[model samples]
Target: MTTEHLDGNALAGPLGEIFAVDVTTCTGRCASCGLTTPVASLHVYGPEPGLVARCPGCDEVVLRLVRAPGAAWLDLRGTVCLRVNLPD
Candidate 1:
């Protein structure tokens, strides 16, 4: 069977709970492939062990988020940098 996945836009709700900004609109560069794209453009999978987002260019994992009781863990080592837009 094929593994089904969703676009990073799915992260909005989960990430919104943690950040004040819309993180899905942020651009993140892949540490593995150096491809830069919006977080909303990445491929996302899973909500069981948490969410895993991968780069569209190389399919390398760019972000991972795990939520537990009263806490959330976010791993972004696969991402070189994230560009978040701020309102002036």
Candidate 2:
């Protein structure tokens, strides 16, 4: 018998989502001064290193903040529908 094989990754996109903050979207507060400032550039945020300020809306806090929990995903191959369960 003759057969052909295909690589699943052949269809993957060249640009995958980078888990990072968009500098244009980052606003932080100054720890030394009571001021809300936008991050000058994206280079400021690296992988859990260095220091940046907090949300400017609240000067009492600095740029450092806890990360939110991510949405849980279940891989159900050949599934035919959608389902979601949120806690109370």
Candidate 3:
């Protein structure tokens, strides 16, 4: 058997579908390690209970997304803040 692992870039499409803007380019500050980087740089894993995004610096879970038939849940507790570029 073989296992396939993907990076944070794989999250771009799914996140784009949920957010009106592109989240891959957004910068997120890791609460655990105080490191800030593009959201696309985070380590991503799983589609089981939900998609988990972790900080590359400290391996802390920065975000979790779960999409249901009619609902979606996004958790960002491990991130201090998310800096997104909004065009005017």
**Which structure among the candidates has the greatest lDDT?**
1
How do all models score by TM-score? 0.95, 0.24, 0.88
Encode model 3's per-residue lDDT on 1-88: one tens digit a residue.
1134356786887788789888989999999999999998888888777788888888888999888897888999999998989998
Lowest summed lDDT across 10 adjacent residues in model 3 is found at 1-10
lDDT of candidate 1 over 14-81, digit per residue (tens): 99999999999999999999999999999999888899999999988999999999999999999999
Clashes of 1: 0
In terms of lDDT, the poorest run of 10 residues in model 1 is 1-10
For each candidate in turn, give its C-alpha RMSD to the true structure in angstroms. Answer: 1.2, 19.5, 2.6
Spell out the clash pairs found in candidate 1.
none
lDDT value, candidate 1, whole model: 0.94
State the C-alpha lDDT per candidate. Answer: 0.94, 0.28, 0.85
lDDT of 2 by residue, 1-88 (tens): 1123122121111101222333333343344453444443212221133222223334232322223245322221222221222347
